[model samples]
Every structure is written in structure tokens, then in C-alpha cells.
Target: MSDFGLGVSGLAAMFALMILRMPVGMAMLAVGYFGIVIMNGDRSANALLVTEAFSATANYSLTVIPLFILMGNIASATGFSRRLYEAAFAWVGGLRGGLASASIVGCAAFSAVSGSSVATAVTIGKVALPEMKRFGYSDALATGSIAAGGTLGFLIPPSTGFVLYAILTEESIGQLFMAGILPGLLLTALFMITVTLVTLRNPEAGPRGAAVSWPERMRAVLRAAPLLAIILTSIGGIYFGVFTPVEAAGIGAGLIILMALVMGKLPWGVLTDAVLDTVRTTAMLYLIIIGASVLNPFLALTQVPATLGEGLTSLGLGPYGVLLAIVVIYLLLGMFMDGLAMLVVTIPIFFPIMTGLGFDPIWFGVVAVILIEMGMITPPVGLNVFVVKSVAKDVPMSTIFRGVLPFWFAMAACLLLIVVFPQIAVMIPQAMFR
Candidate 1:
């Protein structure tokens, strides 16, 4: 068979395995391994797989993943998530749909610390869901807000998506981290706007609550100071070249541990749990990376994506059209596949096309992260939605999906803004690098 035909068959087989409930990492590994063996003989394919997995996992840079994840886990265990929600609620609870809005803001703040989408959903949902419900928030509003808000975890700095993108494209992690800032803030604003508009349209979603005094608001902010400081220290440090990405991750992790210990929040039990959780999460991420590394070389050898890129370039669709097509494909794939899995699988093909078409890699990384942000709140296989659903079983999946509809539109608007004004995503990185 032609390489293109082999690529197509492999993709179909992978999807079928996904449908049958196979683990995404394992499924990708299986298809890629077999495809490589078929394309080349078994002996060469085995050698490549062994070398790829070892090199990909053993790289010192990948250690940043576990450190960053540990920082988030420690923060979550230490009750920072609760403080964030309280701080947000104190400021916005009086407004219509304020609690839900606050939840989104709180989630964004948490995202600065916790870069994983599903982790953010689970952590924030645990903190905000009950409080919102107790305040007479509907199941749809409360659950949906958490689901949608959790997506910011993948956009905000300290983001795993940005880290992975940097690794895949061979871009500087610091530059990508800096580039993500404005886009992340834009997404936060868009989410808040969605919440405000929903409340304005139907006040019932947000019951009138008591406003906080200025003094109390200040106090609430003070309570949230640790998280704010942590974010600024980690992200700001990286952007300003005060530290490398891994160093920043280490500093952040250490600070989180120190704070937890000082506050008497980090008991032995919690520390143990955090370590275990981080290990499990990191292992899963690395497995996906290993699989992708094995497959990427094979895909490159096929030369199909390269040929397609040339074909598209020759058609003169221009950079914008190519970008639009990529975004559409990402959105469609998101409905059926996990965001990380989809990113790992497609970025090898997509990033080359994007760069070949004259798009900035840093800008494209932010764009891809935003698309993943949408994927987390989208239907069928939205990971964040499922995370929230697992916690709030009383709310049907469909209602949670309905609740995120407005926020999803807001996300689309953010995407359009970045597309129209590429500078929104690129300026910080360029300024910093220059």
C-alpha cells in the first residue's frame, strides 16, 4: 500500500480501538508500532521504538512535568483552591450569576498553579460545586461553570499543553510560556463575559446575594495572596529569564511545599497522596509522549503530511485559510478524542504545516492550546465535562453540556480575536525574546 493509504488505515484502526475503550496511549502505541513494522521490517521498528521511548522519557527537561504537576497537587491538597473560590466569591457574589462567574475566575487562578485540565475540573469542582449549590445555584450552572472553567488550566501559564508544545516543536518553553499570557487572560475575560451575559438573560441562574464591603474584599484578596504570588513567581520568573522553565517549576514546587508546611496544611498523609497522584499523572503523560515520539518518525518517513502541506501551499489558500482548516479539524477531532492524545497525535503533522505556511510557532502554540481549551468543554468526550460529571452525578451530562454552550461561544470569540490580531498571542514572546 502507498504510505498515504497506510497512514489512513492506521488512523482508522486507532480510532476503532479508542471506540472500544482502549487506553489512548496504548492504542496509539499499538497502531504506530505495527504501522512502523509494516512499513519497515520488524527489527528496525523494534529498535526505533526502544530508542524513542528511552530518549523521550529520560530527557532531563521532561522532569519539569512531574515538578510542575507536584506543585499543583500540593497546592490543591493544601486548600488553595478553596481560598481562590472564596476570594472570587467575595468580590462577585452580589452580582447576578456572580457565584458562577467567580467560579470561572477562581478556576483561572487555580489554572495558574494547576496546569492539567481534568485536574483543575476535579479540584475546583470539589471546592466550588457544593458552595454554588448551597447558594441556590442550579445543577446546570454550577456543574457547567466548573467544567468550562477547568479548561483554563490548559491555557494559563504553567500549562502542560504549552510545555508539551514546546517539546514537540523544539521551541523555548520560556517563550511559549510568555506567549500564553495574553491569550490566557483573554480566555478568562471571555469566560467571565459569558457568565455575566447568561445572568443578565436569566437572573434565576444567579440569585441575588449580599455584597462584600471593601475591607472584606481586601481581606479576601489577602487570603488569596499566596496563589497570586505563586503564579507571578513561577510565570514571571520564567518570562524575565530569572529561571529556566524547569527551574521555575522547581521553585514553584518548593514554595508550595513550604507554604503548606508553614500553614500546617501539609500533613504526611496529604504529602504522600500528592506524590502518588503526581507520579500517576506524569507516567500517563510520558506514555503518551513516548508513543508520539515512536509514531512521529514513522509518519515523517511516510512523507504524506509533507506532500499534503506542499499541496495546500501550492493551492494558495494562504496562511489564514490553512490555520482555519487546522482549527476546524482540531475541533472535530476533539469531539471524539482526548485533548492531550489528539495534540500528541496531530501536532507532528500540523505544526510543520503551520510553520511551512509562515505562521509563528509561539503564536500557533497558543492557538493550539486555545483549541484544546475548547475541547475540554465540548461534547461527547470533553474531559473536563466528564470530570465534573463524575463529581456531580446528580447533573446529567447533557445539562452540563448545555450550561457550557455560552462559554464555548465566548471561547470561539477569543479564538477569532487571536486569529485577527496575531499580536495578541505573539507580542509578549517577541518582546521578551528580542
Candidate 2:
């Protein structure tokens, strides 16, 4: 078979394996290994696999993944996440749809630490779902808000999505992190507006809570100050060019540990559990990176990326027209595949086309992340929706899907704004890097 034929077959097999419930990394590894053996030889395939695995595990920027994850896991174990929610609630819990709005705010704050969407959804849903239920918030509104809000973890600073995009496209991690700031905040605001409109249309969906006293609100902020400080130091340091991503992640992790210990929140057992969780999450991400490293080379040997780029260019679709096509492809793939899978598999092909079309890599990273975030709340396999279902077991999955529909629209609006105003994604990054 021609190299292009081999590449096409490999893609088919990889997707089929993933659909059959094989782990994503393992499927990519299997396909890439065999494809290389077929196209080259067994020795070449083995050597490529070993070298790529080592490269992925040893990459300096990749170290940021584990440290940031450890920060989030420790924070979750030590009740810091609860304080974040409490602070958000103190400020906004009395407004109409206040609890739901508080949930979105809490998610944004937590996303500054945790980069995984599922973790953010699970953590916040556990806290906010029951409270909203007790306060007579409709199941749809309560569950929907948490599911939609959790997706912020993928867009905000320290996001794994941006990290992987950086690795795949050879872009700057610090710049991607900075670029995500405005778009992330934009989506968060749009989500809050969705909640407001929902409550406005059906007042019974989300009723107001008792007002919080100013002193009480101030106290709540004081309680959550440790995390706020950590966020500012790590992300702010990056923005000022005072620290690289690796340095910022390490500093953030150290401060969280020191603060937890000082506050007596780091019990021996809790620390152990947090470390184990971080290892599991980090290992999974590293495996995916390694798989991409191996698979990407095989795709290169077959000239798939170049061919796809030429095919895209040949369609007479101007830059924006091609951009729309790529967006649709990502949205469709996201319905069935995992977000990280979509990133590693597609970026190698789509990224070149985008940059060749004169699009800014940093801005495109923000736009791509937003599109994937929308899929996380899209129906059927929307990962966050299922997460909310697991938390609110009594609430039907269909209801959770229905609840996220508004927020999904909010995400689309955010995507539109970023498309029309690329500076929203690039301004901070440009100011910092220039």
C-alpha cells in the first residue's frame, strides 16, 4: 500500500480501537508501532518507540503537569476547594440564580489550580449540587451550572489543554497560558449571563438565598486567601515574565503544600492520597504525550499532515472558511472522542494549515480550546454532563444535558467573540512576550 494508504488505515484502526473501549494511549501506541513496522522494519519501530517515550518523559515543560496536578489534588483533600466555593457564595449567593452563579465563580477560581475538566466538575458538583438541592433549585439548573462551569478547568491558566497544545504545536506554554486568560474569563461571564437569563425566564428555576453580611463576606475572602495568593503568584509571575511555566508550577505546588501544613490541613493520610492521585493523573497524561510522539512520526513518514494541509488549502475556502471547517471537525470528533485525544491527533494536521493561512498560533490555541470545551457539554458523550450525573445520581442524565444546553450556547458565543476579536486571546501574551 502507498504511504498515504497506510496512514489512512492506521487512523481508521486507531479510532476503531478507541471506540471499542481500548485506552487512548494504548490504541495509538498499537497503531503507530505496527504501521511503522509495516512501512519500515521492526528494529526501526522499536527504536522510535523507545526514544519518543524517553523524550516525552524528560521534556522540561512537561514537568509542570505533575506539580500543578499535585497542587490541585492537595487543595481538594485539604478542604481548600470548599473555601473557594464559600467565598464565591458569600459574594453572590443571594442574587437570583445566586447559587448557580456561585458555582460558576467557584469553578473559575478552582480552575486556576486544576487543569482537568472532570476533576473540576466532580469536586464542585459534590459541594454545590447538594446545597442547590436543599435550597429548592431545580435539578436542571443546579446540575447544568456545575457541569458547564467545570469546563473552565480546560480554558483557564494552568490548563492541560493549553499545555498539550503547546507540546503538539511547539508553541510557548507561557504564552498559551497568558492567551487563555481573557477568553476564559469571557466564557465565565457568558455562563453567568446564561444563568441570569434562565432565572429571568423561569424564576422558579433558581430562587434567591438570604443575603450575606459584608463582614461575613470579608471573612470568607480571608479564609480563601491562601489559594488566591497562590494563583496570583504563579500566574501573575508568568504574566510579568518573572517565571517560566515550570518555575511557576513548582512554586505554586510548594506554596500550597507549605500553606496546607501551616494551617494543619495536611494530615498524613490526606497527603498520601493527594500524592497518589497526582501520580495517576500525571502518568496518564504522560502516556498520551508519548503516544503522540510516536504516532506523530509515523504520520510524518506517511506525509499525512502535509497531504491534509494541501487538501484543506485546495478547497478554495479562504482562511475563515477553512477555520470553520476545522471547527466543525473538532466539534464532531469531540462528541465521541476524549478532548486530549482530539488535541494530540488533530493538531499535527490542522495546526500547519492554520498557521499557513496566517492565523496566529496563540489565538488559534484559545479558539480550539473553546471549541473542545463546548463538546464537553455537548449531548450524548459530553464528559462533564456524565460527571454531573454521577454526582447527582437522582437527577436524570437527560435533564443534565438539557441544563447544559444554555451554557453550550454561551460557549459558542464565547467562540464567536474570540474569532471576531483575536486580541482577546493574544493581548496579554503579546504584551508579555513582546
| Candidate number of the best TM-score | 2
Cα deviation of 111, candidate 1, in Å: 0.5
List the candidate 2 regions with Cα displacement exceeding 4 Å.
none
State each model's CA lDDT, in order: 0.86, 0.93
lDDT of 2 by residue, 245-361 (tens): 999999999999999999998989999999999999998998899889999999999999999999988999999999999999989998888888888899998999999999999
Task: Show where candidate 1 strays beyond 4 Å.
Answer: none
Cα lDDT of model 2 overall? 0.93
TM-score, cand. 2 vs. native: 0.99
RMSD to truth, every model: 1.3, 0.8
